[model samples]
Target: MNAKPRISILFVCLGNICRSPLAEGVFRSVVTEHGRAADFMIGSAGTGAWHVGNPPDPRSIDIARRFGVDISHQRARQVEAADFNRYDLLLGMDRNNVQTLRQRAAGGTLGKIHLFLDYANDRVIDIPDPYYGGEDGFASVYQMIREASEALLSKFD
Candidate 1:
């Protein structure tokens, strides 16, 4: 019998320590809840190199934890050329990240990069970064990510 293929996804933002990590954690939680975790390979990265080795922002971690998801283990990483070929989908948190990814992508790789909220049914197109905002900002981001994650998972069905 032929083995099943896994769908690979990469979430991206300005810095891996914020929105992208939250997206990764939320999406992972959704897939696992649906019992489809093994059917997909998930990861996250950022467009900038500043936080490449740091953990997700403490605010992001706390917000995820409140939602029953743990993102503390995720370390920040900058988007790499190899990632274009590795993931079937490269989800950007905002238009700027998508534009940056497009610039870095080789000819055919551009097709794999897209805005994460494009999958969401809501009118919101961008997930604002809460890195320098208050706790409420993190909570708001959590809701947006959770909604988008659910909508994105529906595409796989």
Candidate 2:
């Protein structure tokens, strides 16, 4: 049997209540489906501390539950300086998140930070924020992450 390389990924957003958690959950689900779940370390965090220690947004949990993905156990937290040394890739939900991460990155962290959609082969688009939108908005964001995560997985194969 061939051993797969384990890659650590950190998904980041503004508050971590919506986008980041959803991206983490969706990306995890995709990797599991591809039988590479064991080959990746996935986590989520926020740029700010507003929602630190809180669970993902209720709306996000509801939307994910509808699609059979569970993000209920995930909690919101701010990205720490130590994360730069821990994760192999730091994925941002949008341009702002990427900028925030870049501003705080130390050492070689800047090179690991990237917009999540940068991996998407066909639809290169940012995952829209669903915090103020409806269920459909969450679903759309999920699809974007799903596609992007698949492309990312391909890169490691």
Strongest candidate by lDDT: 1
> Can you write out model 2's per-residue Cα lDDT over 6-88, one digit (the tens) per residue?
78999999999998998899888889998888888899999999999999988889878887899999999999999998999
Which runs of model 1 end up more than 4 angstroms from their true locations? Answer: 1-5, 122-124
Worst 10 residues of 1 by lDDT: 1-10
lDDT for every model? 0.92, 0.87
Instruction: Evaluate model 1: give its TM-score.
Output: 0.95
TM-scores for candidates 1 onward, in order: 0.95, 0.91
Backbone clash pairs in model 2 (N, Cα, C under 3 Å; residues 3+ apart or in different chains), count: 0
Compared with the true structure, the alpha-carbon lDDT of candidate 1 equals 0.92
* Quality of model 2 by C-alpha lDDT: 0.87
By summed lDDT, the worst window of 10 consecutive residues in model 2 runs over 118-127
